[model samples]
Target: MDTAENRLNPPSQLLLALEVRGILELQAFFAAYPLLRYAPRGDGHPVLVLPGLGASDISTRPLRTYLKAQGYAAHGWKLGPNHGPRDGVEAGIDSRLADLAGRYGRKVSLIGWSLGGVFAREAARRAPELVRQVITLGSPFANEPKASNAWRLYEILSGRKVDDWPGREAMKLPPPVPSTAIYTRTDGIVAWQGCREQYSPTTQNIEVEGSHSGLGHNPAALYAIADRLALPEDDWSPFDRSGLRSMLYPDPLRSDTDSEAALRVSLAV
Candidate 1:
């Protein structure tokens, strides 16, 4: 028989439970509100979604489909599987952003998950005029390299040193363009502190109840994304806590330091 400690500590078991819980929560939230099905429509500027480290475009299929159904021109980063820092990767990202902007005839919105979020922010910083807005899910930006246990595994697999990677420096925010970062306290992968952003008027940090692996399918995250995308071109504002009191406790954006600490402790357990 498996001991309670062993069962709880096993990476596979814990990850599976988190994934299951995330799916159940998503179903319950969507079922409660039928009107939440509405997705933004029209030939709006393209929204490019980037997958996390080691994730291929397939991982983001659900999100892309949902965005398309909502009427937005959503696209995947078709640049092969994300394999960490590599030669020509940065240039490739620039080319993709430029191509999308030229084709759409407007600034493109970026929605990156995990490491893809880091890349999206960097692209926005490099060309703010060409980029309209950015949204990231469960990205780690505040902490230094090696902050998360998973980073060690990633480093070993990719044979690249994260500390030497330029992406780490690019995590810094650029000029204000409506930005929203959604994270959860129960994330079993990256530290929640890494997902936070501060010191910007247009930036928002939304705290949802979920695990990192299932953020793409979480109902609260979907609703939040829909809400942000639906906002009129000029009405983009920081996240407001007045309405979400029932959803998440203690607004995660109250203060960067406190929120980061609280989130870190919550996820450590």
Candidate 2:
């Protein structure tokens, strides 16, 4: 549940215990692989996948593979592990985005998980013309710097205080391109509230059910990603959750308020 007060703090430690469920989500992904064929296919546009904190391209291989099978030319960040925008990271992603767009003669779509999503959003903002769209998985972009359990680890790896990072305020605004934020309230790392995007014509917030770490491979998340990627270059629209789809992807607008009310009741009890 998300509330202004709760948003001020990281998710409860009890939630971290749920991260181990990521293994189960992985198994589910493989089990559902056959069904993934029914997912929407893309137009062979270039897509770049970025990994999360402490993760290398290796972590995004499964996702990239799926995207490739869908006919998109998916590429990894290829910048080693994501250690929170070290000296060359910002420049590296910029160069990669420019090179891919230039080589393919098309704007590149970006899919990033966790900290990688943070980078993806920033990259899109830095060069909207080079970006087709941005999709983020469990990335804490719209909340306070300390609203994540990994802030300490981020400080250690990036050698910068969580609050002192550059562009902390500007990053909250949606990029100029179509953007999707896929998140889970059951997330074991960052607060789910921070993982949302502000309402906009080109931006959306999608809620799935899973651990924070498994979003990259979570079947629901994967399906949403595929659907978003399949949209024609200029035909972008909000994700449709009519009929049966509503059962899978909750209405974040309603659910957020409902969950907050539920939390208030629970606290009062």
Candidate 2 C-alpha lDDT tens digits along 1-269: 65675656777776687688788989999999889869999899999999999999998988998889888999998999899978999999999999999999999999999999999999999999999999999999887888888999999999988888788879999999999999998777898888999899999999997889899999999999999999999989999988999998888887355343444476479
Candidate 1 minimal-lDDT segment of 10 residues: 5-14
Give lDDT tens digits, candidate 1, residues 177-257: 778889876667776766778757788888887778778767778767876776666667755557644455347745545
* lDDT scores of the candidates, listed in order: 0.72, 0.89
Q: How many clashes in each structure?
A: 3, 0
Candidate 1: C-alpha RMSD to true structure equals: 7.1
Task: Give the TM-score comparing model 2 with the true structure, all chains together.
Answer: 0.93
Clashing pairs in 1: 40-70, 140-194, 141-194
Model 1 has an lDDT value of 0.72
